[model samples]
Target: MTVDPFAKGGLHQAEAILKAHGVDAYFRSMAARTGDSHAVIDGRKVMLAGSNDYLGLSTHPAVIEAAVNAARRLGTSAGGSRALSGTLDLHGELEERIAAFLGQEAAVVTTTGFQANLALSALLGRSDIAFLDARVHASLLEAARLGWGRVRRYRHLDTAHLRELLAAAPDDAGRLVVTDGMFSMDGDVADLRALRDAADDFGAKLIVDAAHDMGVLGNRGAGLAEHCEVEDGLDLITATFSKAFASIGGVLAGPAGNVHYLRSNARSILFSAALPPASAAAALAALTVVETEPERRTRTLDLAEGLHNGLRTLGFDTRPSTTPIVPVRFADLAAGGAFWAALFRAGVFTNLVAAPAIPGGGAMLRLTLTANHDETHLATVLEAFDTAGRRLGVPRGPDLPPVRLTRGDGRRAGRR
Candidate 1:
C-alpha cells in the first residue's frame, strides 16, 4: 500500500487541516491592481491592508517612469553575477545611493532579503557566535544555520538574557548579535540601545535587519539604528527594498571594508544574477520619495495610532506595539480564524498568523497600515473590525490610552 505523495487524498490534506481549524484559507489570485490604498483581489476592489507599501511609492509616476527608463537603457536583466558579467553601472549607482541615504560607507544590493542575510552569514559567520532574537525573521536564522555558526537564541527583545549569554562567552570569541529592528508580527521596535550597549560591553559586533523599519522609520527613513542614535554602534545593517522601497532587492550596508569583503566571499551574491536594471531604478526613485515626502511618515503614524487605539477599544489584546504593524491577538486558533473570515466579509483583508510565527497557544490577525490609507479607508477598516469583534463575541473594553513617542526617554522615539 505505497501511496503516492501526490495522490488526490494527500493533496487535499492541507485543505482539510485548515477546515478543521475553522480557517478556509486560499492563495488569492489577484487581478490587475495599483499600489495605492485600493487593489483588485479576485476581481473585487478591496482596500489594501496587507501591502507593505508604507510610503505608497510603488505606483508613483516618478518611480514607474524610472523603472521604464532603466529597462529601456539596461535591458530587463543583469544576466550574470556581479563578479562575472552581471555588474552594471546601475548596480553600483543604486548601492552608492543607498549607502549615502543610510549613512553607511558602502553597500551591496542582493536578489532578496533572504539572500542578503545568507550572503552576510556565509561570509562573516563561520567562526563567530551568533546571538539571535527568538522572534527574528526566518531568513536570518536560516542564514546562521547555513553559515555553520554556533547560534544561540535569546528571548525576544530581552537584553538581560542576551547580556547573560554574552557574559558567558569567551572575550576572544567572535560574537555577532543580530535582530530585526521592528518585529514583523508584533510590530514592536527592538531595544537597540540596550542591544548596542550589550554589544559594546561584551566587545561584540551588532547587526540589525531593518527590513520593516527602513523607509517606515526615522525622519528620513534611515531605520531604527539611526532613530536610536546607534548608527555608529551598528557593525552591519541589512534591509530589503521590497517593503517601503516598493522594489525587489535586499541591501547590506556597513563599513566599506566589510562590503568589499562580502562581495567576493558570499556565495549567494557571487553566483546569482544581479538585480534587474528597472528594479534598481525603482528603488532609487522610492528612496527619493521617502526623502522628499516627510508627510507620508506623519500620515502613516497617525493611521497606526488610529488602528492601535481602535483595536484595543474593541477588546482585542494587541500585544504592546508602537508601529504600523498591529496584531489583534486571540485566545485560540479557532477564534482567530473565524475573526479573519468575518473581517474579510466586512470588506477588509488581513494576515492570519498562528503557531510558529507567534510562539504560544494563541493566534493573531496581523494588520499593516500604509501611508496610502486615508481617513475614509481607515474608518471602513475600523468598522469592519468592530463588526468582526461583535460576530466573534469578543468582549469590548475601555480604550487604553495611546502609546506616545517621547523625545528621548529611550521609549518609542522617531518611528522605530
Candidate 2:
C-alpha cells in the first residue's frame, strides 16, 4: 500500500495538541465591536485585550470620513498593478505623507507588510549576506530563505553576536542586518542605537521592521528609530498600516534613489494590485491624528505600564514589556489553553501564543492595549485576571507594590 502524503506531516503534532485542548477557542470569531475596547464574541460582550489598534484610530470619525470620501470618489479597488494602471494620485500623496512623517527621502507602499519584506529579501539578499536576529518575524526569515544570499541568525537582541558574525564575513562581501523594532510576541524593544552603530562599523545596511512600534513609539510616532534617536542612521524602515494607522497596507521608506529602484524592480509591487483608495485615505488621515494627538501615545503607554504592574503584583509573570503589548507567561501549553479559556469565560479576550510562535514548551497570552481603553475597562480586565489566576492555581511570584492607574489629568493615581 502506498503511503498518503496528505495523511500526515509536521502539522500532525500541532493538530493533536489542538484537539486535546478543544480547538473551539483558537479561531473563534467576533460578531461585532461596540467600540475599541469591547467586542461581541460567541454572543457575549468581551473586553478586547488582544487587538493591535494601538491608537484606536480604526473607528475615529475623521478616518472613517476620509475612507468614505475616497470610496465615493474613486470606488473601492485599484483595478491593476501599480506598474500598470493602478497608480493613483492618492497613492502618491500617501507615500509622500509617510516619507515626511518618517523623515525619509522617499517611500514605496505595498499591498501588505509581508510583501514589503519579501520584496526586500528577494532584491537585496541576492547579493548580500543576510544576518538576522533569531527572534525576528517569520516573514523576514522566509524572505531570507528565498533570497540568493547566505543567511545567518544571531542571538536575540545580542549586538555582540551580530558584530562577531559581521566581522567574520569576507571583507568584500555585502552585508545586510535585519530585525524587528518591537518583537511581536514578547513585546520587548530592540536597542536600535546599538544595532545602528554595529551595522555602521561592519559596513552593513540595516533594515528595521517597525510594524509594532509605529504610532506608539518615538517622539512623533515615527517608530523605534525615532524612539532611539537613530532615524538618520537606518538604511531602510518598513511598517504596516494595519496596526496603528487603522488601514491595510505596508510602507518601505529610505533614500530617494533606492526607493525609486524598488518601485520599478520589486516584483510584488510591479505585479500585485495597488492598495485600495480607501485604505490610502484612511492611512493619511490616521497619520494626521498621530501627529496632532500626542496624548493618545501617552495614554497608551501609561495603560500598558499600569496593566503590567498589576499583573506582576497579582503574582503573574509578565515578561519585560515596556510597551502597549504585554505577554503573560505560562508554564506550558496546557496551562496556557486553560487560562485562555478561563479568561474567555470571564468576558475578556486575549491571543494565545504557543509552540511555533514561541520556542521550547512555553506558551503565553498576548494582551494588547489601545488608547481608547478607559479606567473601567482596565479595572474589569484586572479583576478577570485575578479570578482566572486563582481558579487555575497558577504559580505567582513575589508580591510587588500596588500599581497606580493614570488619572484623566495624566497624573498617576488610584493604587489598588
Candidate 3:
C-alpha cells in the first residue's frame, strides 16, 4: 500500500480490495427519515436495523424544540473553542446534569466521542500503563499510543489475562485499565466486576467509554457500570450523545480534580471548537426524556432480545447479546456482503463489520434496535434475515467463537 491517498498507484489497489468483497451497499444516501426505526435509502423506504438511536429521542418533540430554540437564539457554530469564547450557559447546564446522572463529581464536554478518549492524553503519564481489552474501541488504542503511556492488551473478556498483565507491570507505575462498557461490535458488555477487582488488585484506575451503554443500560440508564453495580468502583467514564441522546457531542466525567486537569490540559478540548448550542440543548432535553421515560430503553432491549433469539432459532449464529446492539456472524466477508445486499433489497438496512474490523477476516452484520421499533418490525426483520441466510448459505452453524487478532496486532482494530 502506498503512503499517499492521491497517489495513482494506490487507486486500483483500493478499488480492487473493496470490489472483491462486494462492498457497494454501504454509505448510500438516505432521505426523508420518518423516525429512528425507518428511513428512505436510495429512493426506497427501509426498516433501519443499523441505527444507534437506541431511545428514539432523535424524533422527540421536546428535543427538537430545544434544538430549534437554541439555534434560533445563539446561531449555529460555537464560534470558538471552549478555552476561549465558545463556552456557553448551555454547555455548563449539560455538563452538570450529565455529571450528576453518571454519579461523577465533575465533567467536561468535548466535540465528539473520539475526542473524549483523546482527552485522556492529558491524564496519562509517561510512566503509566494502560491495560486494554483486545476488542476495545480503536479510539482508546489510538489514544494510548498518542498519549504518554505504554499499551498492553489482554484477551477480550478474559479477566484472567488482564489480571496477569496487570500483575506483570511495574509495581510503582501508574496504571489505567481501559475498556468499552458495551462493545460496539460484539454487543456484549465487559465484566465490570472483574475489571474493578483487577484494577483494585494492581492499584490501577478504571476508564470506561460507555458510548453504547449510556441511556440504554442500568436501572437509571446510567451505563454498564451502573447496570453491573460497579459504578462507584470505577475512576472515570466517557460517553457520546450521538447514539441515545439524539445529538452530537462527547462527555468525560470523573473526579472534580481529574476533570479540571483535562479541561485545562487536554489538547483536543483546548484546540477544538466547543459543541454547538443546538447540540448541547438537544442533549439536555434528551437527558430529561431519558430520565422520565424508562420504558423506551426497556422496549429497545426487549426488541433486541427477541430478535437475537429469533435469529438463533433460524440457525443463524447471533452471539447471545442482551443489549440493543446485536451481531450476526458469517462464514466470510463475501457472504456477509451478499447477505447485507440481499437484506437491503428486501427493504431492510444493516451495517457490515468486515476485516480488519474483526478477527478471522470474516464479516459480521451489526443489527441494532430502537425504542421506535415494534414487534411487527422485529418480525419483518427476522424474516428478511432468515431469507437472506438461506439464500446466501451463511450464518448457519453451531455456535462458536471467532479466532481473534494476536496481542498488539492493530490491524484488527478496524480501519473501517
How accurate locally, in lDDT, is each candidate? 0.81, 0.83, 0.83
Error of 1 at 321 (Å): 1.2
Candidate 2 worst ten-residue window by lDDT = 406-415
Clashes of 3: 0
Off by over 4 Å in 1: 1-15, 20-23, 123-126, 395-399, 405-416
Model 2 vs truth, CA RMSD: 3.5
Determine which window of 10 residues in candidate 3 has minimal summed lDDT. 407-416
Ranking by TM-score: 2, 1, 3
**lDDT per residue, candidate 1, 17-47, as tens digits?**
5589766745766676666667677577777
TM-score of each: 0.92, 0.93, 0.91
Which of the two candidates, 1 or 3, achieves a greater lDDT against the reference? 3
Best by TM-score: 2
* Model 2: number of backbone collisions: 0
